[model samples]
Target: MTYRIGYIVGSLSSVSINRRLAGALVALAPDTLEFFEIGIADLPLYNRDLDGDYPEVARRFKGDVESADGLLIVSPEYNRSMPGALKNAIDWGSRPWGTNSFARKPTALLGTSSGSIGTAVMQAAMRNVLSFLNVPQLSSPEAYITFKPDEWDGDMVTNESTRAFLTHYMAEFAAFVERVLAHAPGHIGDEG
Candidate 1:
């Protein structure tokens, strides 16, 4: 009755607001859902030539995505788009010419920023790429928020409204994950 989700945080910074948001999601998630950060910092910039003999790091990242039941991506807008590290990871996941690891996986996106835009354009760019990768992303109840430092008490969001909304979204994500697993071919509801 547990679902393991492989997650990606677009920023490499230790103090990334988007990374904090992802951690908050984990704290709010139902017991049935567990998250593991899929590290992308070690991956080289994806090159097609490297696809034939992928580095062990890239292969491990791909395996993490393939083994997991779903994906959770939290990205902050960088230059009006997702960060380079995350994009490189995505390219690595969908590689070797028709051997994409992310194909048909259930996914969700969330992010926060200091600005009013709240990662909207970054998410849009990500959506286009994920569409090509065949990742079925949740379309409703999106979390795009302006970061408020005063609202965070340690890793948890102290603001009542933000906490409430995130809690509800995590519950919904639990159900979405369940449905994705139930319908996945050969899934026996115990996939890691």
Candidate 2:
């Protein structure tokens, strides 16, 4: 069965490397996976007051999260943590009490940065938040890509080793998603 995967790119920059990395991952993904971006650029800073009467954009964001069979969060490190825009989107998805849109959604987190360590710290912080929301995540084959202009050709990874690793990561994530969904209550492919 095909899986509808919603991806969030944490950077708001028009020329974001993380965005390019996300594109490469999508291109390398299996045919059974369909990737779509979940835009976080327009979401306002989340506030509890607004949760009572969620804005149209917030509603749309939540709807996107709810409809997806799986999620991929591609983030960039900002001051040793996740970008503000990404945090804002996460807050919107987990708000209004007992209405977490990310609950039980199979997720995989990866990020790219110019530094050698990449987005390790930011991913750690994100893991805490997503864990609290009960989002199931793929924890293995952690990707901490160091952005290098020479290693990429537009939206494709030109480095042979990096491309092979990313391709393998995508395959692993596809299997993880399918396994999680098959066991989810009332899922279409559920055999139990």
Candidate 3:
């Protein structure tokens, strides 16, 4: 069975490496995973007044988040926290106080950075946000990468070991989503 997974990128910059990494992970997935991109860049800053009844763009973004069986967030650490654009996307999804799209969804986070730590701190920070939003994420086998020039093609993660790790991680995440959805029944987002 194929699963619809949301691949959310944190950065809006035209040259976002994080977005490229998300693309790479999707490519690494076997035929069983159907990954979709969630547009965080086009969304306006979230406001409660816009909840439920949303603008066209907000509705589209929310639909992507709400329908995906699981989430794969590839973020860049912006000033020690997640990028405002990414947070805004999440806020838009986790709205109306109770009808959160991510409530109980299986999610995973990975990031690539120019810095040495490879967005590790940002990953930790996002865990708190995921907890509050009730999105259950894989806590171990953390995924992170420090960008190395001449090491990767655009939208391709080239490190041999890192690629292997991510392939394994994604398979495990697929199983995790299957387990959660089996127990939760209809809560598993869109099973497309």
Off by over 4 Å in 1: 186-192
- Model 3 per-residue lDDT tens digits across residues 63-127: 77778888889999999889998888888787656667788778988798999999999988999
lDDT of 2 by residue, 1-192 (tens): 999999999999999999999999999999999988899999988988886799999999988988899999999999989999999998998876778888888999999999999899999999998998888899999999999999999999999999999999999999999999888832222111
Our model 2 lands, by Cα RMSD against the true structure, at 3.5
Query: What overall lDDT goes with each candidate model?
Result: 0.86, 0.91, 0.82
Please list all clashing residue pairs in model 1, or write none if there are none: none
**TM-score of every model?**
0.94, 0.95, 0.91
Question: Candidate 2, after superposition: displacement of residue 142 in Å?
Answer: 0.5
Best-to-worst order by lDDT is: 2, 1, 3
| Cα distance off (Å), candidate 2, residue 45 | 1.1
TM-score of 3: 0.91
* Stretches of candidate 2 exceeding 4 Å from the true structure: 185-192
